[model samples]
Target: MRSQPWRPQRYATTAVGFLAALLAFILLDAPMVQRLEAPTLDWRFQLRGPIAPGPDVVLILIDEPSLEALGGWPPSRFDLARAVERLAAAEARLIVFDLLFATSSNSDEEGRADAALAAAIAEAGNVTLGYAFTFGPEMLTRLEDSNRPPDGTALQRYRRSPQAISPLPHANGTLLPPRSFSGAAASLGHMSVLLAPDGALRSEATVVAFEGTLYPSLTLQAARQFHRLPRSELTADVGQSISLGDRRLAVDSRMRLPVNFYGPAGSFPSYSLFALLNGAVPEAALRDKAVIVGSTAAAAVPVFVTPYDPALPSVAYTATVLDNLLLGRSLVRPEWLRGLDILAAGLGAALAYGAARRLHPLAVPLALLVPGTLWTALAYLAFVQWHYWLALAVPLSLMALAAGFGALMRSQAEQRRREAVARERQNLSRYFSPAVAERLAAKSEPYSLTGTQSATVVFIDIVGFTGICEALPSERTIELLRGFHSRVERAVFGHGGTLDKYLGDGALAVFGVPDPLPGEAACALAAAAELQTSIAAWSDELVAEGLPRLKTAIGIHHGPVIVGDIGGESRFEFTVLGDSVNVASRLEGLTRQLQVSIIASETTIQRAREQAGTAGGNIPLGFHRHGDVTLRGRETPLSVWVWRPAEESRVATRRAAV
Candidate 1:
């Protein structure tokens, strides 16, 4: 046996799979893969269902009903003023508006309404008004502000060194609340929403850098007020924690916080502005809760996209963020996650490689599914139970791809092995069984005898072949022999019997060679019957073609035989050399004396009957016992049975009785 040379292609498949996983990990933030993360987040929400919002937060919606009652879109400042007054009277802990009052109101009733709203804010003392940061030609063309801080005292008290970090987005221009409203309000926060590349709101910028100053987001400002934290104690460190008294948040380098939405829109308790102004809302619902007032009417306010809802109100988003902070629960993509992703990909690659290399080809598909299913389950568990979002789409896909690649590579290797065996079988077919050639190809050992084994040996010969060859032309005789050989070969291979060798007008077949299989005797008998039927059909075809009709005789014997590769190393042949093979050949010669197409020794008949139960069904051999006779080279006489079809046997039995 010779060893095969090392092939690089063998390891290349696994390497490719692993490298693909690494590539995907490195490009985790790419736009193509980022889109996949959305569905995984959605899966978490769907699996967990809806959770109740934190008890300390409430959403005050200026909904369609409010607009209808106020006579149209954009409720008058008076309506807003009365709503604010109601909240103030209820003694709410903090009130933050998602609505931006960047422009002044009209004269007459509007001016009075604005003044009234401003007075309500002054009275509340905990109210924080929203100021947007817009970027457009209108703002660029206009004269810039004096760069005055809205909350100068608080800004100066909590300001960090300007050179420490610069992660917040620099605004082109600021949208401040009307001076009167700003002066009346206790604090002001920016209401600039950040949208993901896919147009979904997944994170919130807690702070924005503007004109050498940092501004807290609306949610952050409202939360700070609720905690009653002084401006001097608050701190913002980029890529670190944002400390407001005892409530500290671990934010990303961009100072953005991931929002774990409780549910879809309207998950929180909400009361319409009309209901509040009409005294329909209970005072207790507003008391001590972090209330967010904003328009849910799409026509009036910007309709933002969220994981659970596409048309979520901006105010609801702010409320959810506040809820996340107050509850100290938010999805964090830690810095170490990249390393973890790489580890997962590496593990998947290893599993895929192992499966492809060790498992059977038929089992490859099922083996590949294990990693995909396991990772998905782990990802979901991490998100729901641990609050860690592990992106699995890319990692799992890469794993499956690797597994498939490995399977393909293995299949190609197997195919090549088969082709090599097929070429060997073509040559070996001259002196060995196809089954023996296949077994030899599979093993890395020299072919040899495995001692004595019970086998069913068959011999087939064309009757009167010598006379037919002498009478016909050489070409016609060769064609007839070729046709006879083809018919015998099909019968042998079809029944799982091995075509041992061709002997001019005769051929030898053996069963239970290379590997022992159940029903070997029965299979050999079946092949003999097939040979007779096929040759009979071929003889009829020859007669129709104006050629001589021919007949064949087959003999089957089952007993111990010494089977192995015989002859020298330069030219060796595989064959069985024992009394059983000799008996089978002699039985074929006796077929002429008995005038029967098939003759099976008593050994073959008895073995076929004994193994019939394990062979899955009844044996098809129908034979009647023929008297025993001493065969040449045999010390003892052997009993034989003349093979006959079921119908022929019935007719013979009837004739005998008559």
Candidate 2:
């Protein structure tokens, strides 16, 4: 088998596919791609449904009833103090507040209320108070005025290394509680949540920087208090992970942790502050459990969008973080994961291109779909089973784009090939019969129409052509030849014969040269008989028009011949070369001497008879045996058969009567 020739189009198509994928890779960090990709993570969370949170964490919500019982939205500090006192009395392991008390009260009554709350928090000794860091240009002044740094001892206690917290989110101003409250709290952690570009809170900064000091998040502080881990056991390895005792949790370069929610807002065990205050909750329920206290009143606490809940309360969101920390499981997307994402994009593009090349163009999308579906399933499994955050949208996007571009290029290449074939067919039709030209042009691979083959050759010419031209003008003579050639072309092509070339007033046609047919001899005979009758009719019309009458003679022979395109580099002619061609020409010359319209060699007659018998049909015309005769350029006398059209006899009789 011959090796197929190289095609540049295939390489071009593959390059186009890769280029499309490269473009997608470059835009991996674009806001549009990020926005589109965010929902996929949400989908994974929803599909995984809800799981039971660790029993170590619980929520204390200051809900609508609590607000009503306390008389307003922002419950008095006296009421807050009472709630803290109640939790402490129940021996709650830790009380973390997701609230802020940044300013002193203006009235004496409110001032007394503030002092009472601060006293209660100091008494609890295990309470962690939440504060926020203020950002933006407008807050710079407020940040400077209120920049009383927290106790250095407390700050250094959580700081493993300054370099570890350098990359964390920076804040210019602090939203700290009043001095009374800040000094009374056992620990202070920032209550700053990180939102995605689309304003959905899916993660939080585990550590934040302010005034050259690092502060832990409220969730982290709560976890530390619950676990009772030593300060040395809590370590921050920025851009990699955070070690809490023996457990390591992944974090991104910005010291942010992708929060993995156990479920929606109410997944963890929650108790109403109103119930805790009224003694409706059992003391055992609160004992030794880490409690997060915040208001759930719509007007008091801010609502955040989470993966599982569109409007999740801030307290529940904090509880989710603490739950994840206690369980030592959170969605992992470290800085190194970006390298894997890039690899995935490239590999997906290559797969799509290879599939498109092997499959049909119409099925390109389906081919892309298979790998895309598989990858999605695997990514979801990774998320649920391993808590791994694999890039989804970028890889799938690259595959789709690559397949689309590749298919478009392939379609264009096919169109160009078809156009070239159409032009080649038109050119071939000029030399060969329509049927032969079509067969040659239809081949997809390069091929040769040249070979040595058995065939029936036919030759036809106008008699007395030179004399007839002398009596007519040049224009009229040229028109006469065109008419004659047209008639001959019709007869030859109609019978599947290749009209090789025209010889001024004559033409040579052959059957079964390019492709062999079982009835090639019979077909040749049929063509000759038809030509003889048509030429006779044309001569009668010429006579009626007062033009000189015309006559034509035909000869056919069947034999093996060499057929191919033969000539110099500049030009070529597809024609047959063999003794059979010469024999057929000589037989045509004998038509004038024998005074017959058509003549055939004995071999041709025998072949024709055989073909007709095989086809179960009668021969197109009858042949009368003509005795052996010597022909020009032949040493042996060739036996032949001759035929005269009945149309010629009828024309002669009609002319006599006229």
Candidate 3:
């Protein structure tokens, strides 16, 4: 058959849809989302500069020295005044106190302490104080006429704690500013946790939205001081830039970015108040730096404990804002990238399906490895170059799935194709030899061959066929033909021969071509014998059906011949076109001439001789050489042989002279 390897197969629409759907699915269920939510690994990818050089950022611990020097819990009121004096003298730009002054008193001693602190605050106007409010919005469940602080709190304001399913006055939401101590300093910032979806305080804050009003973040307020920017100057420019004071602050407006969490966990500095009050680093060390005074005391801090420092106490979350402000660093993930994540997942799923469908088995590993590695490197590059936390999970996951699907689909398709081709080859064997039929089928087109080679061919015919058909009905003739063909086919196949063609009442079978059998003549003889035995067995069944008994004669020969497909596109047959084939046919007819069964040539006789020698003299067969005789077409005659088993059976075979 002629090779036409470049032709494209008809493409299936269902296949495309399947490929696309599979890819989309892979993108959506990316496996890295769990890791993305982890605080530690996330910090590693997003962390960057402005980390205060380790030594510059100082944590002044309010230790036992401060406590013992000025009693605890509402520390000696006089102590607050003195501390403010010293901190103001130290030249701290923003001295923030993470404590509230909520008590009311007119006693001379308390008044004197308050006056002294108030005086210090008036002088050091850079002081900022910490304040806090209840968790959420405030409202009244039902309207009330008076604004007299209500009987307690509006039920809506209370947020209905679970235990409050029973009767109790709702708690009022407190506005902690004047009463909570922010007014004591020039500026006030909330000490609230900007809880993330993963509940890690890596990113600081955006706008603190509540009750339809947006308040400045702690970082923003401190930044306002650092840059000396007013609320009006806090302009967000085109999402790409922001302006605060003279400084165009390096920040994102939609602030869900990565923060440079410097170390694995507890990298935040801590110091003892005893050393600070005693001027441990000398007063020169405190000058020109922003001083944020908060608690390192166990009961005072809220939630800063980390694995690295388990014994560490919680501090006001506001200290984090202060830390971020003093250093000019920020982690930035643009608003646009989240949408990209969704798209990435979907696209990945489709590619996976295509890769699954398209690649061959051996090529599959390269198909997966190249793209998987490329996507990962692109993700890392995005982090370094753009500060964009483009998600790696969905795309990487999709690539993996595509590779897997490609491998699985390739495996399955190959198996199915092999089975299908095998079945087709077998079904054609009823008419053609398996070797010839396989070559024809694999051509991707019907038979078209040229040239030829040496081959062994066999022919079998039903005996007394004309008389049997004449005696039988048309359907009976068909049944007889079907039964006869079945026996011949089974015999030919059992001995590894091809039934090349079937002419009514007979067939041409071959043992060698497109491939040769190890012992073409011997195998051919076995098939012929099996055919004869089968025909004898069928004779009784035919007689029982009120039909004549059936008999068959087979001819086998091994010799040189020109073998190829013959005839036009409309019809063709793989045939041996030479004198060897003619002699084989003549010899089959000569079964009657010789009054015997199988036949052979000198070549097969010589081959059998060598095979017998190779088998340690065990193969039992012999041939008597006959001198050359002229065949119908040949000027030169060819020698032949007659064969029989060493222990002669009734069957005898004569080789035709060519």
Candidate 4:
């Protein structure tokens, strides 16, 4: 078989597809695609279901009931002090406030209440206070006035060049706890949350560098204080892990950590502040747990947009991150892993192109479906099984585009080829069945002249055709010819034989002409048998209609023959011409002398017998050897065989019995 010619446009489409994938990968961080990623990440949580929250984490929520029972908002600092005292007495491992107390309440007794809250924190000795960072002008001015020199006291020191400072989230100002309140807490951490482009808060700065000093996030500070890690033991490098004693925090270059929420709001066990304050909750419930105290009252604290919930209490984000760090289940997508995404996209595009090119035009979509589905499953598994954010949309888009584009190109090319072949098939259909016409049209070689191949040639003619036609009017004679042609044509095509042409009272049929048949000789014999049966039936019908009976003699021979257009190009006919064809015609004439409806050359008989031996019962007719005789064009004797229908033998047996 000849190879197809190369077309650059086909590959150009594939190239464009691959480039499209690359473009998607590049735009992965764009606002639109990133928004797409958020839900995909959320899908992993949905797929994994809710994982059990860490055993050592709990929330002491200042919820609606707590405020209703306590009879106030912000619950005076003195009231918070009482709650802290209760938790401290309960032997809580660590206490973290997800609240801001940067100023005193504008009341006369506010000073005393602030002093009481400071005393409670100093007495607890394990409390971590939270503060917020703001970029407002007044906050910036406050930070400028209170700007402390770079402190060399922190443990998580970052490696930076003399002039190259560590890149961190910059905040002009912070809403600090009151002086007394800040000094009493064991440590203070910033409660800053970073919202994604879609305004969903899915991550937070692990640590923020401000005013020449680094401040750990509220979650990080809580984890550190709980683990009792010294400042000297904590260390971090830009774009690397922050090690604090036994816990390691994976952060991006900007010191951001993706919040892996365990579930929707209320995933953690919560004890109402009013219950704890009133001794309704037991110390056993608080023992050994890191307690996070925050307001769940909608107006007091803003809700966070998390994967699990859109209006989750802001404190849940802090608690989830703390839980993630404590359990070492952090979700991190290292900078280097994006390369894998690119590689996957490139490989997917290459495979998709090859599959489209190799597969049948109709099967290209099916071929592309396998890879597309497998890649998506793998991406989900990467997130679920391993806490890695494998970029999916970008690479998957590339593969789909490339595969689809390649398939489209291949389809277009095949469509053009089919259109050309369809035109040729129409011409061939005039002389052959549609099946044979398609085969001839599909061949690379032309049907006009210049072909010699092994084939089975058959000649079928009406017995006593001249006398029968002369007795009928010209119109009736033409009708008889039409009926004869239909019967012969049906038999030939029904048995995979090609009807080559009509010859007035006879017709030329060929087996294995346009294309080779597995058993051309057997097929020819079968077609002859079918033609005999059909002629008998038609004769019965004609006799009943008061018309002349019809019979046909068929001759078949298997040998080499010249097959192509025989007439001049101006008016050519696709037909066979050779000694083999002449022999078949002679055998048809001999059918009348032998008193049989069908006769075949010894060559055809041998071929049919061989085919029958390979595939049982390929030849259904009973063949009897006929005496050899010299043909008109040849001096040598040509052996022949006669087909005696089994029905005739059966009828003779019945007559004898009668």
Clashing pairs in 4: 155-231
The regions of model 2 sitting more than 4 angstroms off are 1-21, 145-172, 207-215, 228-248, 413-454, 460-488, 500-507, 513-519, 529-554, 561-577, 589-598, 606-628, 641-658
Q: Give the distance in Å from residue 388's predicted Cα in candidate 3 to where it truly belongs.
A: 5.0
Where in model 1 is the C-alpha error above 4 Å? 1-21, 106-109, 136-143, 146-168, 211-213, 232-234, 244-248, 357-363, 430-439, 442-444, 449-658
Please give the range of 10 consecutive residues that has the lowest summed lDDT in model 4. 145-154
Tens-digit lDDT track of model 2 for 100-214: 7777899999999999999999999888888888766555545453465467313344434556666677787777788788788877778887788889998878877776766
lDDT of each: 0.78, 0.80, 0.55, 0.78
Specify the highest-TM-score model's number. 2
The predictions' CA RMSDs to the true structure, in order, are 9.9, 5.1, 8.4, 11.4
Q: Tens-digit lDDT track for model 1 on 195-278?
A: 776788888887776666677777777777888877655677656657777666767656778788887888999998888988
Please count the clashing residue pairs in each candidate, in the order shown.
0, 0, 13, 1
- The prediction achieving the highest lDDT against the true structure is 2
Which candidate order results from sorting by TM-score in descending order? Answer: 2, 3, 1, 4
How big is the positional error of residue 51 in model 4, measured in Å on the Cα after superposition?
Answer: 2.2
